[model samples]
Target: MDRIISLFSSSALLLFILVVQNTSSVYGNAEGDALYALKKQLKDPNNVLQSWDPTLVNPCTWYHVTCNNYNSVTRVELGNAGLSGQLVSQLGQLSNLQYLEMYGNNITGIIPNAIGNLTNLVSLDLYLNRLHGRIPTALGNLQKLRYLRLNNNILTGTIPFSLTTITTLQVLDVSSNRLRGYVPRNGSFAFFTPRSFANNPNLEFPPDAPVAPAPAPLSS
Candidate 1:
């Protein structure tokens, strides 16, 4: 009886291990598919994304992609790769993503609101692109965001008030865009200066304090 009980216990342990492994594999495959969808929409003139193979079970081995120990994608650094075309909404599927550095590319089109789903995101660097359209209000969902640089783009429309909710935000550069309307002075925005919104011809600057006039009548 002792021998039979020991054998049953071992079998149960093995089955548990197999279930855990299978679960990890399923999650990793989902992340890979999301990234592959992005690669399909891009114009990779330099073949930098050649290593992205959908047949693979995980994208952790792909170039410019980083994954956590659990095989979940954590970062995607494809900055200045000369990649054009619009960003894919599937990128929001990377739940573990921390840094998304795709700046300095020729990418165009409206910023996808789906990106707001990256709750773990720390830095969102999509600056220096040809992207145009309103800043997505959904970005406010990223409570962990620190560096939000969308500067040097042709983006239009008012700055989303939702952004002010990110108290963790530190470096915000939306300069050189076509953005308009009131820049929120509450919360984290109160720390930012006019330079952060500089070169936007239509954007209303924070009202400067009135200057005192000289006593010209006393001199006369």
Candidate 2:
């Protein structure tokens, strides 16, 4: 009876260990699936993201993927990888993400509004792509953003007023796009040069095209 009881206890302990292991594996796989879904949304030019296999079980181990000590994804640096395709809204699922770089790709399509969900983002570099559409107003919600580069894309429309709300912004370059309108005269926009605002025909300038000052109050 002693032998049987001991064996049963050992088996139960082993089962518990297996359950914990499976749970960790599941967590990793779920995150991996989210990435895989993103991969499907993008068009991988030159097959660069071919190695982004969800079956790897842990995206943290994948190239360009950085993880926190807790093994959760913290950054994704796929810059100059030649990826293409529209950014899907699911990218917002990376709750802890701080940096995302996908520059120098042929990716086309509008910047997803869901990117505004990455409130913890510190740097976002999507330059030199074929992406079109207006910059999402939701982006102004990224309070932690420091470096934002969206140059050399096909983006159109006026800059969102919410963008001026990113007071934490240190480096912003929306140059070389189709953007047009009155550039905000505060924050980073105050210092931007004609070069930064070049290439767009409809963009109004300061001093040269000063906004007609608000009509002065009528004499009392």
Candidate 3:
């Protein structure tokens, strides 16, 4: 009777484990779709994006794409790949993204406001691209961002004071752009140097105050 009871308990435990495993859900290719959207828009001269297959249920297998243990995309290292074309808004869907390194490309167009949605971002390096337009105020939304470089682009606009709120920020380079107005020298901006704001001939400096101090972060 003891032996029979032990076998029944083992069976029940096994059944429960199976049920849990079967119910476990994947991120469901949402990441894949987002990546494919980028692939469709980018002009990959190096065939770098050739491995990006939309048919796969996940984007982890794609080259230059890094995923965490959870199989969620965490980094996209595509610097100096000779990629062209504008960035897609789908990139904002990568909630777990930590590094977005797309510098030294010929990419053009405005930095999408959707990029502000990447709350988990630690590095946002879009420098040395042919990108134009105003640096989005939405970029200040990255509370976790530490490295923010938008230099060597054709971007035009005042430095968004909202960036001052990023206490985690350690490096900032907005030089060599067509920027105007005054730079924000408050909050985290206190740590930056003249080089960070250099090359923007039209930008006013050593100014009175920022358009506004960094405000409280909004809910993601």
Candidate 4:
């Protein structure tokens, strides 16, 4: 009887330990998965993320990662790093992300429209990268945006009219690309100078483009 009781006690202790470990592991993996998707999208040249080993445990201990009080990602700063890769749509899963600073890299790819799901995003700095593609119209959904810099890219397309809906935008830079078309007449464009749209071989700033003729009235 004594031997059976001892065996049962040991088994119960082991199970308790496993339950706690599994709970912690589950939360850690959730955070890791979010970042794993981001790393997979971008091409990293310097192997900066080599140490982001989820197997080793919490991402809060990794470099260039910042988490909030609830252990959710808040800021992702990879500035000046020799990284390259596409911005994957999986990044949208980081709904609590407030700032994503990825400056000075060879990264190339279209900005994923799924990024619009980051409703809490405040600053998105993708400047000084080799990224090419039309800025996603979904970015206009970021109502809290304060600074947007997509300059010095090979992007070719008209700026989406949806961007005008962002009433909070203050600094908008889309210069040095292949963009063309009359700049939108609202939001920051209402009084922006030629500098904001400079160096585009095909663009015609507002007032430069001739007005379209009004539609003729139809017979009753």
Scored by CA lDDT, what does every candidate get?
Answer: 0.93, 0.82, 0.90, 0.81
- lDDT tens digits by residue: candidate 4, 70-154: 6677788998898887777777877788898887787788888988888888888888887787888999889888778888888
Better-scoring candidate (TM-score), 1 or 2? 1
Clashes of 1: 0
What is the TM-score of each predicted model, taking all chains together? 0.90, 0.79, 0.84, 0.78
N/CA/C clash count, model 4: 3
Best candidate, TM-score-wise? 1
Once model 2 is optimally superposed onto the true structure by TM-score, how far is the C-alpha of residue 10 displaced, in angstroms? 15
**Candidate 1 residue-wise lDDT, 38-123, digit = tens:** 99999999999999999999999999999998889999999999899989899999999999999999999888999999999999
Error of 2 at 163 (Å): 1.0
> What is residue 93's positional error in candidate 4, in angstroms?
0.7
Stretches of candidate 3 off by over 4 Å are 1-28, 207-220
Point out the worst 10-residue segment of candidate 1 by lDDT.
206-215
Candidate 4 Cα outliers beyond 4 Å, as residue runs: 1-28, 56-58, 208-220
Candidate 2 residue-wise lDDT, 1-220, digit = tens = 9999999999999999999889978877776777788889887647766778887867887778888986777898888887777777877877778998988888888888989998999998999998899999999989899888899998899988787778888788888898887777777556555555667777676565444445688998
- What is candidate 4's CA lDDT for residue 21? 85
Of the candidates numbered 2 and 3, which has the greater TM-score value?
3
Candidate 3 or 4, higher TM-score? 3
